[model samples]
Target chain A: MDMKINIAGVELDNPIIAASGTYGFGHEYNEFYDISEIGAISVKGLTKSPRAGNPPPRITETIGGILNSVGLQNPGVDAFIKEEIPFLRKHRCKIIANMAGNTFEDYCEMAEKLSAADVDMLEMNISCPNVKAGGAAFGTNPDTVLAITKAVRTYAKKPLIVKLSPNVADITETAKAAEAGGADALSLINTLTGMAIDINTRRPILANVVGGLSGPCVKPVALRMVYQVHQAVKLPIIGMGGISNGDDAVEFLLAGSTAISVGTANFTDPYACLKIRDGIKTYMEKHQIKTVRELTGGLIVESK
Target chain B: MSYQDYSCQICSQQEIAPNIIACCLENAHLAKNAKPGQFLHIQCGDPASMPLRRPISICDVNGDELTIIYEVKGRGTKALREQTGKVQVLGPLGNGFLVDNSLYKRPAVIGGGIGTYPLYLLTKQLTNASVYLGFRNQSVVTLEQEFCQVAEKVTITTDDGSYGVSGFAITQLEEDHKKEVFDIVYACGPKPMLRAVQAFAEKTGVPCQLSLEERMGCGIGACLTCNCETHEEGSAHYKHVCKNGPVFWSQEVVL
Candidate 1:
């Protein structure tokens, strides 16, 4: 079994990573677990300028999960590159910078700056509904997905991992478009657009009428999409959605993810990422698998 | 970068009073550092009821553990109450009270409704203090005898005259001040009550510090969800209740 696999041209110690927004720039979870425990970290979605973020009621929890419309809130690209980048570099992990843009230009500007900054990869966010240009408009249409991916891919010197939104009619067409646009790798599925209603008040639970849903409820949907997209495109795939424990992480990898990102779980337990990290090695050792890279999409298909 | 949330296990859960529960946590370190008037961010469920965590104030600290007492208010609080065993809590966070006993000969502790939870610990830290707590009626009055153990005088007020004193808590705290001259006033509870205490402290020109309340996210200061405007400015020109204070000098806050 080979331990080394390539994401674009860069090498990661493992295929497990703490996802964006959930990890909060990796510096935070470092307090509970060692930074070296995970393969990489996708920092929170950053824009061209600092964002104080949306007004209150940005987050609410539902019966099996939580919904959020944080509006891609961050201290902007400059602060992230200046203040946040140095801290990320101190840790031994592949730093995947997640970039969000209100317009194509904001995407280009952030990608260009982060490309020059010290980072191993760039994760382009096309699924965020918090911004006008984000959400379904950029994700649903294949041509728009291609155009935006092409635009950001030009400025990104590192591996450009275009995150695909699952709020579309067909996931394959969109994944193919990202491949056509030169995405080095792909990630799915970004939070599905969802809303919860307060029956007594007859009002939406979120301050924003709608929000993105992530957690255990969406795992089957995400796994099915990852499997579908894996067949549609040749790009290395990073899968995420309601992943909590090592068993869940293995399920995503076996479903055809080259790597997996742990979201929602970080809030359930701050040390959840480290738990998955250790759990993966234990799983591999028990199965007599010498390397995690061997587990990527290694599911034995049973006859229907 | 200094903040993170964890799934805190319930070490001990005690029913301190009717509709009020005192929860002890497995966090040895948190119980070690919490001071009077401090708070903790609770994740009501494994995935959290809201995208963020709910903030609760510390009621007592014993050894490597701390206690938070609360009445079920909404979904977040309701989820916390239903947690069968251990629940996740983020704190002992926010600045606790200023208990510098050297500056004041006598201290007065005031709490209103569920806000009295923090005052239970605040009065214990003062050299000499009186406990004045108020609730809606017989259903809300909690921790009276426990407060009596720490305070020189324990005054309980209920709106229906079902408890010790009739009328509001402020009326009880200000009934008279001639004993030792309460030089410092400390308080917690709903904002209206804290405001009333602030008014009396200002009228007497007595040094006062009030325990404030705000819903929080990351209790260590990173997430700005719990920010409140004050006379003091930090990196962002606002003080975070989860970090700089859930406890602030009465004068330092805008209201």
Candidate 2:
């Protein structure tokens, strides 16, 4: 019955947070439904300065997934803090500022700026592959992960959630590195790098040639990584990747994630988070579970 | 505008030209509210099989029936071509065309190939508008008769000398402008054609609005996909084509 979740001292009425880049400042979705109905919203990826992003043809569809090369096109952090934060502050749910940068200084500057701002959490987006640099690079290596997480920790006054990259060799290593570097919590898995070709045109579908793949296709990989990282670290995990419904959210919760974020599913249905939240409630009721926390790490597997 | 996805009955489906199909659906709200240049994101295949919805421009809206014209581009549209009966769609979405009658009393409408589809709605709304359409050749020329019925004057052209006019549509528009000057120009088509119109608008000191086509993730503003750079004064800003516009002021965007 109780769907509340506490991630790094920040409380969510429910465990559904709209993933960054997928949910833009909550203005668009707010037009569809009362966005305050959802648990929280992670605004679009932000940087120190405005970014123009990639060229046209930034998105290409795949089997049960999509590849996006949006390149973090945003109106800069100052714009977000000036123009967007006040609007976001009007909502009842927590606001997680998803920050991306082309360099370490950019991340630190954004971390410091957002820390003193009105946001509830800082979600460091180190796994964006659509950009040329400082995106997936910081998330792929344990050293960079530790270094960036450590560096960002100094400036981030709010809870720091290091979003892990699935493109890495072992996700647990990076998750452990973030934990070692003082991450309050973690979220995963940012889209997996993939490409699709236009057979008719004999060219890549996306202008960027390669993009991060997300949606139902990557859910299994996301669940596996969340489970592995949960065992490797003691931090609460925000699991995501193709989470379309409450059943999918339940899968992530049982895989040791305290909460889940809806990404690609938001494209298919604007009220995906609300549906997912209701689905989890229905799932809990049917299973006679009292609280969603009971579903965390509830997976029963036999040792081979 | 409401953003919830709706399931509408497929009233009919007809192939208007080679590789192009016109689908008519019965959705009262969309038909009543959908404006020129607004699009619908239709669920192409089974929800489980295809997670991404295909964004299609509304070609015509009559009472409770909304028609969309699309060319088979990929697996999504290929699947859409086979859809029948009831289909789920999320839209009447994005910022539609702003047809400020005060901005331009007499307007010129230009369309290239599939780009001409959305202009049908725009031309219908304009009381006095000139329509110029360009295609590959006579064989692929579509909606010529429809434009002729709505437009004050209609000019059709082809890349090769096989149809109404011997040259590009922009050339025809330029030639016609000398005979009768247009207060404004509205266009949709290939990128180069749009770029040409943008230049023409600047050179002639006439206002122009262009509808852009970009690959999109969410036809709504959620996903930052479908980004197009816009220039205001000397600064450049990015806008989501799916949200901010499929249609923008001529000088506002960089083609």
Each model's lDDT comes to 0.77, 0.89
In angstroms, give how far residue A175 of model 2 lies from its true place. 1.2
Quality class of the docking in candidate 1, CAPRI style: acceptable
lDDT (Cα, tens digit) per residue for candidate 2, span B1-255:
357789999999899998999999999988998999999999887766688888899999999999999999788989889988898888888777778777778899999999999999999988888999999998889998898888898889999979898889999888878878899999999999999999999999888889997888778776777878777421146777887898898888888
Report per-candidate TM-score of chain A alone: 0.95, 0.98
lDDT by residue for model 1 over A87-129, one digit each (tens)?
8888888899988777888888888888899999999988886
User: Could you say which candidate leads in TM-score?
Assistant: 2
lDDT of 2 at A2: 91
Steric overlap count per candidate: 6, 1
Error of 1 at A4 (Å): 5.0
lDDT of 2: 0.89
Residue pairs in clash, model 1: A61-B49, A61-B50, A215-A242, B8-B88, B10-B86, B115-B189
lDDT (tens digit, per residue) of candidate 2 on A163-274: 9999988999999999999999999999999999988899998989998899899998999999999899999999999999899999999999999999889888777889
